[model samples]
Target: MTTEQHIRHRADGSIDTAFYTSQGRTRRSEAAHSMARGVIGPLVILFSFGTLVALLV
Candidate 1:
């Protein structure tokens, strides 16, 4: 990654949402992964809890 990729804000002081770096994926892919995690993480937890409760009951 280049030094220019470290910018976290726009020139107008708005938060930049496109910021992502390649650990093992490109910036775009990383952003998508983050969004998926945010949406799916809650559902996964809910499903796991439901499964455990069903087993116990």
Candidate 2:
């Protein structure tokens, strides 16, 4: 894979959202995965929690 591809995609051919969505920046990328196992799992949970907190507050 090319360096540019490596920045956007993981080694397993999966799109790495973390790469494009880092440092409070986003790229309008699809931010979903079939299974949340790698770095995304915790982010999903953390963002969920933050959303809940905001709604409840």
Candidate 3:
């Protein structure tokens, strides 16, 4: 059995490192925003509840 190795070549005959790096950075930014929202959403909910309770009392 012969093993085959996959090779990638860009149209310009140069390595497309920048394109892959940019994609990775974009994904990382998206993950960070998702995490921030997860934390901030709950805090906002709690704050609103506290404010309403205080006003009623």
Candidate 4:
């Protein structure tokens, strides 16, 4: 995800491997947020497809 895009780079042709925890968000919260963001799109698409099939039937 683009969540790490900001932290994944440095301007001096090196990777930024050092990360500090809980900059207003814990690792758990960040993971849950990422999971929800990932799931919502597919769930919406799947449900909409199901609804369309049901209506057609």
Name the best candidate (by lDDT): 3
lDDT (tens digit, per residue) of candidate 3 on 1-57:
999975455798887787778888999999999999999999999999999999999
Which model scores highest in TM-score? 3
lDDT for model 4: 0.75
Tens-digit lDDT track for model 1 on 1-57?
646555577688976655533333576687999999999999999999999999999
**Model 1: clashing residue pairs?**
none
Q: What is the TM-score ranking, best to worst?
A: 3, 1, 4, 2
* Pairs that collide, model 3: none
Candidate number with the higher lDDT (2 or 3): 3
- Please state the error at residue 25 of candidate 1 in Å: 8.5
TM-scores across all candidates? 0.52, 0.36, 0.75, 0.45
Model 1 misplacement above 4 A = 1-25
Better of 1 and 4 by TM-score: 1
Worst 10 residues of 2 by lDDT: 26-35
Residues 1-57, model 4: lDDT tens digits = 445445555678676545343443577888898999899989999999999999999
1 versus 2: better TM-score goes to: 1
Candidate 2 structure quality by residue, lDDT tens digits, 1-57 = 646533467899898878756733532223333343567888999999999999999
Alpha-carbon runs more than 4 Å astray in model 4: 1-30
Score candidate 1 by TM-score against the native. Answer: 0.52
